[model samples]
Target: MRRMQKLAVLGALMLSGAAHAQSSVELYGIIDTGVMYVSNVGGHSNWLADPGTAAPNLFGLRGTEDLGGGLKAVFKLEGMFSLNNGASVNGLFGHETYVGLRDDRWGTLTAGNQIDFMFYSLVVDRWGPAFPFVSSLSLRQGSFAGLNIPNGPPGNGSFDFDRTLGAPIPNSVKYLSPTIAGLQVGAQYSFGGQAGSFGQNSGQSFGVNYHIGTVALNGAYTYVKYPELNHGNDGIRNMGAGASWVVGPAELAALYTNTENTENGARVAVYEADVTWTFSPFVHANLAYQFMKGNETLKNQKAHQETLSVMYSLSKRTSIYSGIALQQASGGPAWISLVPGPASGGSQVTGNIGLLHVF
Candidate 1:
């Protein structure tokens, strides 16, 4: 009886060790803050408290449990907040929160609030060359707030695809496919939580990416339903394709995007190009241009925006940045710069200098 009990105790200890080896968790986040000067916001030069442009100001936790047989269970919870202010996010894991199952060969399946296809397109190909300097948020989302004349400097106008379609749709499901020969694909779907209405506020998106040595390419498509927009159930469809190439110390990229609102009949299209050069091991500069066109009935008929920025890395986790942006608009309401108020001809200039640190 004593020998049998010893064997049982040893088996229990071994099983506990196996379980410990199969489970793990981690925490991570970033904080960015800076100051920006706008040349003309509401006909005045303004200095504003600007947040970091590289990554979202957020913190998060990630955990995984090995299920054996090349499978694992994973979960993540993240949130975003303002670094300049002491305010904490009120929403539960507003930035991202998801639980999923992953397989080395089969890929991953997850459900919860998560970013859509455009994020992958920008990160993988479209904005790869300009990232950390020019900021995809500024390029893709545009300076709508600065472009509104009557709404002054804080109004949001057209060309905000991510904001309009819900960049991270809640109550969503996503699938990420394993890369094969430098190629990968992903898809997502969100169910709008309107009782008795499954389609309301719902969204769907897909993305594909391919990379080979110095060249990369990506494309994405998304269709979303906004039950309360456009005076009814408005359907919006967005599509984008882009490519980037790198040679030595220089990188170049281009992207084209289309967004249309079916119910409201509003449409917007944009073309953008960028070039980034490494002046030194720690200093980099990026120059970018964007052309935006919208429906005649909508706010902006045509706009041209240009951005120039430089970044100096203090270390792997810290950097200092400065940037300038100019914008000109024709057939639009007014000239609005990327960070300032709208001008009479929809032309304005903005500049910013700031620091960012990651941990």
Candidate 2:
């Protein structure tokens, strides 16, 4: 009887150890805020609290559980909020919420709300340094509302047409493949959830990345069907390619993206280039330029934008930053992304200073 009891106790202890070894979880978040000055917003200059210029205000939980045979169950729940008013930016856990399985030899498969490939390939893998150095105002959104993105924000019908600002796709299933010979690939599909149609309001995305030495190349394509357009058959289509090279303390990158609305024959193309330099362990700078042009459907609207930013790190998790952005538009009023409204004239300028902390 004593021997049997000892065996049972040992077995229980081993089971507990195995279970502990197989699972882990982590919590993380970032908070960023400061003040901003806009030279023109609706024909007036104003100063306001910056919400997410340096980096987005976000919090998240990520966890993984080992399932033996080099596989694991993984999940992430992330959300965004406003630092100025403590308001949820996209609802609770609306930024990203996914559960998936990962295989050591393969990659991962996940389902839920998630970003598409345009952000993953161009913004993240290819020109990753730009995000840390440039402000969110550098993204593209001009006076080209003819694109008429369905369900876009009021008065701004073409917000984030390129989908590089971490826009989420709802009810999506995504697959990412492991890097093979310096190349990796990913794909995603979103179910429209329409009762009688499979393609209504659906979305599809594909992305690929290849890296060798200090150079990386990336490409992505995305198409989303909207019910308000062509009886849910016509939609928005986006495609882009980008490349980046690292040189010691500096990284240089360039990208081109095209967006089109099939419903109304509207199209826009954007060209961008930027360089990021690390001057010291705590100081960094970035300079960037962008040009956007629209087709006849958008009244041939065009915009030219330039941005410069500098940052001083207090530590690995905290920083102080400042930036200025200038924009000039022809064929319509000037509009910068994240600004409250369109410029009354053809030009606009903005400056900002901010603090960032991560945990």
Worst 10 residues of 2 by lDDT: 1-10
CA lDDT of every candidate: 0.68, 0.85
Q: Per-residue alpha-carbon lDDT of model 2 for 1-359, expressed as tens digits?
A: 12322332343334334446668767899999889899999889999998578888999877777889999877777889987788886676767777778998899998777789999898989976656776787777888888999766787888888988878777788999999989999999988877888888889999999999989999999999888899888999999999999999999999999999999999999999999999998999989899999999998999999989899999999999999999999999898887888999899999999999999
Model 1 C-alpha RMSD vs. true structure (Å) is: 8.7
Task: Name every residue pair that clashes in candidate 2.
Answer: none
Best by TM-score: 2
Compared with the true structure, the alpha-carbon lDDT of candidate 2 equals 0.85
- Error at 314, model 1, angstroms: 0.8
- Give the per-residue lDDT of model 1 (tens digit) for 107-137: 9998777778877665544556556665533
Candidate 1: segments with Cα more than 4 A from true spot: 1-19, 89-92, 124-130, 141-154, 162-166, 195-197, 230-232, 333-341
